[model samples]
Target chain A: MNGSTSSQKHPLDGLLRTDRIPHIWCPGCGIGTVFSSSLIAIRSTGAEPMKTAVVSGIGCTGRGAGYVNLDSYHTTHGRAIPFATGMKLANPELSVVVFSGDGDLFAIGGNHFIHAARRNMDLTVICVNNLNYGMTGGQAAATTPYLAKTSTTPLGNPEAPFNLPLLAYACGATYIARWTMLHTRDLTQSITEALTRTGFSFIEVLAPCPTGYGRKNKLKASDLLKVYQEKAIVKNGANPAETILDLEQGITLGKFVEYDRPTFAQNYKAVTSD
Target chain B: MEPAVLTGEHFLNGDVACAEGALAAGCRFFAGYPITPATEIAEHMSKRLPQVGGVFIQMEDEISAMAAILGASCAGAKSMTATSGPGFSLMMENIGLGITMETPCVLVNVQRAGPSTGLPTLGAQGDMMQARWGSHGHYEIIALAPASPQEIFYQTITAFNLSETYRLPVLIMADEIVGHLSERVIIPDSSKIKLRSRPRPKGRKDRFLPYRPGANGVAPMAHAGEGYMVHFTGLTHDEKGYPVMTAEAQAEMVDRITGKIRKNLDRIIQVERYRLEDAEVALISYGISTRSSLAAVDEAREQGIKAGLLRLLTVWPFPEDMVRELAKRVKGLITVELNLGQIHLEVQRCAEGRAPVVLVGHAGGSVITPEEIVEKIKEQVG
Candidate 1:
């Protein structure tokens, strides 16, 4: 073997299903780590592989549906939640998971994500946030931090990024959490707990993209992860209205909000059912 | 033995009959929004699918409606959606995706006027060409136009069969006039009907190309989660269905989709002929407008103009060859429709310069009377 091949590539073996690896993600991408954490979570929950359906939308992460060995769907961008909601309602016995990027979930599919959260449809949405559009080169996105350079935001971006956890909590999601790829084990635990949460659960994973946003911003993937580790604060406010996230430093990470109320589908069943 | 030959009575609109037709086709999932003229189809489906252990959902929009049906179909259930003009437009992108991925599902468009919302509750045959070319890029579709309530009941079954057989989207090209008009329909026993399920690759495992064209141009469908690594895409794909963005792959993929309908023309094309032989002049029409054409032909015959009607039952795989043959024997062809001149052009193409073809139509919210068509026929005769 050549010296180039000597470095260990985090083999996503039995846990990640090596057969489907050499994934369609670009080199130095963070979506693979997000995907691996999701796999680990699904395994920890002990959900049957055949009984789970993985739904995704168009983007770098959307290809997760094809790469994973399960009943998966590679669908249109920003619409995975609505699609998975239908599948869950069709057979409530099966577990449905949605994996997609910020663009696929927030930009094109913002309406669906909120509605699905409101319904509390017993579905899990794992959104991977890489700060910029990773698939079409490094471009500024709704999730990109202020002043970060992107293809679209050449000099400096003026728009503020969306805090996905805060957005989901406000939209009536039963369970909401935010974790970073730097904290792999914690991220996997967050996803696993969200999966078994029994209501609409939303988990946002902040991953470092050394290639797209990183290279453009001159931040290496490892350096970006270190920045997150130093500045990250867990969101733990009792009231969702009082939730806080740092702007200049870094994003807050952890279970930001959780509340119990009659979810959309559950409350709907009470009145509609005889 | 004819299993329990139970029949039901109905003085129902064609839209209601279409719901019964979908249920009879073993469709249990209905996803749609309530739109004029097409609302009854969704209404009946909501009640019937639940009674038969099926599911119905009112999606937020037509985009979700299309996506939901595709999701249901992937889960191994017969699913459908119904809408009018505007909702149909929202559904075009996913419909193209369905055509490319070779997903088998039926979409019923009870067409209304457009060029941008001409009429809401009114009728129009304007979506005929849109059904064939609305989605970007190239693909083949099976479309059935129904003339009355009974045809709606029967053609919906044909739509589902064609969808499953060809593994493509089948359009039920009903107009608002036919959709709203009340008529008697008899829904026969479900078992006596021959419902075709896509042939599974039996004994042979993993060797399934989800898009492999069979002799009849329809391959077997292995629903998702059946352990087949079925790769579906909207881009040009080869036999194994992995998208290959090459010109040669594009040529093969386009031909595979269009060739199924073109090569198996006989099975795809369905037309009903009236007085095709002895008539010197032929009147051609489809959808509810065909009803007016039928009456006009009768009145013309009473006037001794020697004109008869040719009704189009199958609208998509255009009956060009049939029109060519009939045009050879007839002196001329007159096309009548609810729209300005949609199917009239198809008739002209089929006539192929052998005989001159004339158009008799209105904008289609209100029907063109038989007297109006008779007037046009008499003018040609004189």
Candidate 2:
């Protein structure tokens, strides 16, 4: 038989399950962009594919693990962090990454996210903040900005959204960064850096959910990207509390925290040795 | 370094014994939250696991603990967690995920009274049915009930073995009385102990299908970072571990999981019979009530009445065939338990009018008395 033709191959073919393409994300959704960027970052790290595992919680972003050609676990709703935490503790040699949606990682699984960060567990958490629950038909989520219309908040959401970078900073994450899908190069670079970091590293990608968070607000995918282009400011090392997102006010995007401390495994080893 | 098993007789409570048994069974990872009657298991594991080079984590809540064990199991460590009624309820969602993913792990429920935290320090068998059906979906489960510290020690090992062999979560249903009560437990030598491990994938790594079954209907498991590229999910999946959202896929998936246990009931079910031969009346009980029922059976025999006991060791997958055979020969079958009627309904269904089934039960907080069982036996027999 002749060798496989180049015409049939994609650039990131080896990193993804090509047969599982035509993924569940709707057109104009930014999850696919975030997922592809993550894979590129994983490849750039030169990490052994066999020694890396990806875990995801339930939602549109949760399907990221299934399409990746790695040891992937599509876990229950709001449980990816704890699951990845267990994997890291069980075998500290392996690199564990959790890829999930904003609602799953912040709303229902909020407790685990904070605790894992506080413990400085060795994990890379990629949170796709589409603002609303995209998979559940645009319901109001923990990251849904105030005055944004959603299925559950037709009149406009009254509850404030979480400033994720600030939350991660407050929870003692060793490395924290925020970027949008429009900044693919920076997002991929941020993920690459986070993957090599020793403690709990977090990257928040603000992506467009045109079908969920956009339709009611009369914003298309291009409009959202234009907003990011005009209002996004690169303010590295700015105070985390001052970096909250507001459509009217500019949204700051850059690495907010970077430091070194003993991870959970290192501390555990010390205690056991003592 | 700590020895795997103590290998000597020691008077220990049921919770401690369970922890020792897990360590002996090669369980190296434990994640649990503190709950009444089950907290001792976590405490014991915390002190002992580190010495044995095992990992012990006290999670923020029960949900995380359950999820953690599943993750640890996927990382090639035998993992377990312990909790009580409320915590057990919290674990139900993840337990279903475990069932769907076919992850081999052990969950010990040191049951306390509850309809929502009914009694924290007292024993109850109210969660027996919940252990089987609490998770939202159709699935089969294996749960073992232990009546004393010695039995819980042995049963904990059995739970791990069953989990490994069947590639599913196994439950240890120990009530509060059995959990806190102290008794002599003799842990056997490490070399003498038997352990079952999940089968490893045999074919080429590139072609390995995570959910493909073998002759026994159990798929070989490959741990994370093993170069298997295995994908596991809670959605209804095909043999390739790919999500298939169709009724036909659901039928095939649900049938294989439930059918594996149902088809192998003979190997999974365990019941102990005491003076069951040539009996006119049979007393069916499990957990703490089994001890009282045995005493009542002896009293009935001494009084020249032909009464015997059938003690269930494996509660789920209900030992229906054995009960049906026993029901055919007896005049009446009585189920004695701490709850009003849980396993009694199973016994009644299995009897199928071949014999009259009677329930001798109570609300909770304590074990049923032998005198009460004797009274029920007399009333049923007459």
Candidate 3:
């Protein structure tokens, strides 16, 4: 064994509740990487970590709030966005970030997501699109790829998955991007950019739910990572309408949208102050 | 924009009075969806919250509206929401979250008749039991049944104070009649009004246990961005606010959530006893029904019946001990409400065969007449 002092620590030890370590994510699951990237991105923004709050809805990824060493909230199903909205609106000093999964953010919480984006609320939303409901053992989800086998969809899913970037763009999100867990650096960089933005910023991270989704589809952990490496195409400034997650087809990645708009807080202050 | 506390006598509806009460109680955040009878509360908050440097958001639905208040409360803002039966039903899930997390906030249910949108514009007390057990859990709740516009105003402030003191959601259960009825409401001076805040964490900022009980089984709240870095969750958790998936954890958490009010019932429960000093029979009621019961008491007294009215101010921790005492002394108890025997069941249970508890109840499209209550009182006395 290499000579190492017991006092030596991992860099993220300062930002994470290390006691809650040995996390619940399964082996080869991409959520850990995505979560780490989000943490790294938050740190990179140079924002006081104490002033940043993370909110999550119910799911495997929803547990992100529990592990973060910040003022975090683990809310009910499909409610992270609204909870964060309340926090942000109530105290404009706090930077709010929503970290949740596809079934949580898109399916059950779809209405909140659209409305938050529509209002141009000041928030950073990171959706880990594992393609299926990972917490309840791989059920079909709103982002489940068409013809993909899942617990609920034993014979392959019939519904087409959502093009998240397009949905985000349509809902008036000011910042939108997509990246796989394999592209850690780019994902981290995009999230850092999002954390610094004012309006509703959305980042969709394509993570693999190895045990729940990978095993059901007859794909190994390595196979999904390989697919991400080979299929993902960095297409900055591409129309969000064309960005879809299809393994057989090319997976569009990189920053799809970035612009400026008057945030909800700013509008309230402008009209109310004068 | 009006001042936060309009300190003077003014004619106001129950809904507007409730909004003014919230402002006077140091509520700096309001989030809600527009529902009939309760819509005026949200409208008033939207105009007033901004004026006081507070925040008001009209959320997507009742679920989110409930959630937003919880969030704002966690962020150290005294927050509230107003809704009717349909919306209150929608808010049930997040209300459970508020209980589990022990977040301090107020929920004003200006009730309308409904199993589902039963009567949008009319008033009903059918949501009384719902207010107590609306959220799916065994935890106890604090609810106030305001009888008039003036009472609703003061009770709204009391709801905020109790929520802050107990570190959980408090309910202002006003039926549609009181919410829409305009009456003379006296607003007291700001300095005269009492305000309570959740206890704050002291000393060390690091390793602050968010769920650790301070006094009366309530924990000190650390708002976001205050350097506490606290974690709060809907799941059963330990003192450190980390999720502990064990029966032991659930027992401890649920105990504190319930025990806070249960152990402090004397301070939490309030009842206005009218002519109960020597009455042989009693009329038990709350909210709009309390008004009718008061009139019944007077009419029954004039008719040579020793009838008294027990108006419930705080309904959830149902003045059980007092009811038990009254049941033994009174010949019988008559429960009056807009719904079919909701609080009547509670009176019966608390009476424990000491007295016969009868209900002068209705299906709730209109108010229960005092004559009906008088008849029930006369029957009990006869």
**Residue-by-residue lDDT tens digits, candidate 2, B250-351:** 999999999889989999999999999888999999888899999999999998889999999999989999999999999999999889899999998999
DockQ score of each predicted structure, in the order shown? 0.40, 0.89, 0.86
Model 1 lDDT at residue A203: 85
Query: Per-residue lDDT tens digits of candidate 3, residues B1-382?
Result: 6689999999999999999999999999999999997999999999899889898989999999999999998888999999999999999999999999899999999988888989999988899888888889798999999989999999999999999999899999998999999999999999999998898999899967888898678889899999999999999899999999999988988888888889999999999999999999998899999888999999998998999989999989899998999999989999989998888889999999999999998888899998888888878877
TM-score of each: 0.91, 0.99, 0.99
Task: Report the alpha-carbon TM-score of model 3 versus the true structure.
Answer: 0.99
lDDT of candidate 1 over B96-136, digit per residue (tens): 87887777789999998876766988898888888888888
- Worst window of 10 by summed lDDT in candidate 1 chain B: B1-10
Best by DockQ: 2
How displaced is residue B96 in candidate 3, in Å? 0.8
* Complex DockQ, candidate 2: 0.89
Q: After superposition, how far is residue B225 of candidate 3 from its true place, in Å?
A: 0.4
- What lDDT score belongs to each candidate, Candidate 1 first? 0.79, 0.93, 0.92
The per-residue C-alpha lDDT of model 1 at residue A127 equals 89
Ten-residue region with minimum lDDT total, candidate 3 chain A: A1-10
Model 2 residue runs over 4 Å out of place are A1-5
